[model samples]
Target: MPRWFNTAGPCRPDIHYMLPALRRLPDVQRLIAQEGYFVVHAPRQVGKTTALLSLAQELTAGGRYAAVLVSMEVGAAFPQDVGTAELAMLDDWRNAAEAQLPPELRPPPFPEAPEGNRIGSALAAWAKAEPRPLVVFLDEIDALRDETLVSVLRQLRSGYLNRPRSFPVSLALIGLRDVRDYKVVSGEEDRLGTASPFNIKVRSLTLRDFTAQEVAELYAQHTADTGQRFEPEALALAFELTQGQPWLVNALAKVAVEELVPDISKPVRRADIEHAKKLLIDRRETHLDSLAERLREPRVRRIMEPMLAGLALGDVPEDDLRFVQDLGLVRMAQGGGLGVANPIYREVIPRVLSSTAVASLPPQTSTPWRRADGRLDMARLMEAFLAFWRQHGQPLLGTAHYHEIAPHLVLMAFLHRVANGGGTLEREYAVGTGRMDLCLRYGPDTLAMELKVWRDGEKDPLEEGLAQLDGYLAGLGLDSGWLVIFDRRGGQPPISERTHASDAVTPAGRRVSVVRA
Candidate 1:
């Protein structure tokens, strides 16, 4: 039976693998045929290595190409020593090639390292003696030290002209970022552009996440193999939550199939997917941890902060945006705004970044809300939030995400606790939104909040606050809304002064309340 869920990488042969999408790239095939150097980059575990290995198998099976997939990841340990790094990389390559080669066609002794150009010359000599065109896929190409990486790229570029007859016909550098964005920063103000060494690269391809249809196709494979089916809603929820990120998609499916589902006879349901998501987040797997690490980077912060603030980031360099996109952190929409790439990522980001804040949240009163005839007391919830902010808001504000226009993460933590299980919070923020807008959906009742920070020496923010809240409520189809403003104008004021102040009125006959923290 096939393992439907895969997290490390794709399983061989029986994994219901998809190949046509990558094979369709024109440049990919051209390089494979004409002996060119290129790059295939995307977020870790998004299947860059898997796709390359699959291609390598296909090329080798044709009996017209000698293909090998080598990983440089192990060389990352001795990054500064080029000699040891090169040796480790070469050893990995030789082992992978020998293991994959058919017994009848295996070379007795692999090609030895030659002087001048270590990797390129050895590879060139191997191709020269081989009966087929040489194709090498260098995985984890970015793991090498800056100097060594430059040397390797330059060697490949120099040897490109001697293809099929004297050098490798096709060379691929697969890593976490595109080759073009590689900035080898060594000394003071010394930035070596990736293009300088790898100018011969005709194309850079990014392995994109599986689409909704693809996710469904992958799941159907398991059902066909073992007669264990995922419920229709469960399948939909899987795509909705994972947005087809390969690791998350496979991990969630694995949990549902191997753990959550009772037996082959029972169909996996949406609740199963929810359970899997919770387990994955709780476990804090390496895939999730690696992604969370990117959130702390300044470049990532610049791009993500504005989106969290519901405002557009103007004039950001294309490279920065592309880097984040490759990391699978954000996705661009047709309308030109950025959103959290997928549901799983969206959920993970808030949870990982707000751990401290969530732990310190104040306890709600037993009579948190007063009910009149089984209806929720919306006013009471607001009052509770106000009181909580007064006591714990400043301390929580210290944990606020500073890169964003406002402290959205802190506000989100507060809302997350209050609305947990009982309600849902929908977020809307883009590059140009200027403020973060959240709508709380509790049963049939709906409440909206707009969050902003005091930027300059503005004395009264009443007009801006009113306009913002009015727009949010209108969009949410609500009669009344709250505007929470954090007064950072005083530069970290005392906790006592961070009290909630409201000008109570129903402007435009739509209830509007402003809370100051």
Candidate 2:
């Protein structure tokens, strides 16, 4: 049988082209060797389960430890019921052992105990029955919430002193975040804000995304297997776009080879990847949609809203920053500033944010924006957008829930409607930048746009916007662009009364279409 890229679940080496899942975290084995309990957390579908599964197999195959990877996700259903969660968890553990380990390595039946003590009791029984030291990888440990989450972590911490004689020699909590970010339902919001009970953990480590070279190596595996080579430029572009995000790296190639250019003798090109990226974003597969779902989360919005609008991230908690980083939504850039992890994600964020507003747009909204040759007519598009904004922008703003970036979202929705299928709408915004840059590419023409907001007590921003946009247009090597300044003051007039446009020249003498709304 032939192998292919695995996207939906844990990778099986026998069937999927992959790098060693455990290679990303070299400390796991050392920590386990020292009998330490630690955490392994990363965003969804980045090979957390695959790494644990591979590590378990490697450890158990060494004939020194009896290791198995199980999931706490089964306990997620009984968030408020400690007893039921423990029961479901233990039941699943047994079934998981049967499926993941050989008979000689499998534990004896779990011993019964009080509801609060069931998990500790079960692990004690398993450790006692096994001839070898046992290691347990509990994947999705953060999936449990409230009392159930507290109960499990407490049980694990309680069992820490027993070592190999009465408890697993070493344990790992695997999930999307550290135990600190695990939901314990502290107070008002259903978000994590408190510390964890699992203080016994030695370290909370994250699985880093693949490096640029690893991405090349992984893609080369597909080339070696199917004789369908990815061009060098395609590989580099893939790394650039995905920033070594494991799922996205594989997903882009999977789409390119399987859907775009399946011929074994042919090579995949950079254009294929660009097309695949658009497809992936458009399709909003389960993985990307899962990311989209987080856009509404308060913790996520606290960071993303400001970051998206290119304004200062004021007073955001470090926990919030770490949580967002853990969710793979943002990362520290080269200069120690925060940034969206990758180019594809940069595109994904605004598109997802603008989705509702896009739907709110009137029918045939793009008709006036296109020229006879199917090109995006810049003047017409801007004129149409100004007219549309005067008519319906305020109401459509309600469709976008992020108040800080509502105006940006509304405009993106209209542009998305213009560039949806045949073109690309790319965005570049970061914290403290005070503006969002947009590159709308349709047909052979590209439109460079800068978006700024006129908040209460702020300067008019016209001169500053033109200065900033001059540099932006210079970067794009364009002789002209558009600068849109949105008036978001408290007592601003109605859209129809205030929205207008005029022509201006930047410091570089670039022709800029200036729109004030």
lDDT of 1 by residue, 276-352 (tens): 98788768898999899887776787788777666567787777787788888999887776888987777677666
lDDT of 2 by residue, 336-375 (tens): 8899989988988888888889888878723787778887
Clashing pairs in 2: none
> What TM-score does each of the candidates earn?
0.86, 0.97
lDDT of each: 0.73, 0.89
Q: Which regions of candidate 1 deviate over 4 angstroms? A: 15-27, 104-116, 183-191, 359-384, 401-406, 416-426, 439-448, 457-481, 490-495, 501-513
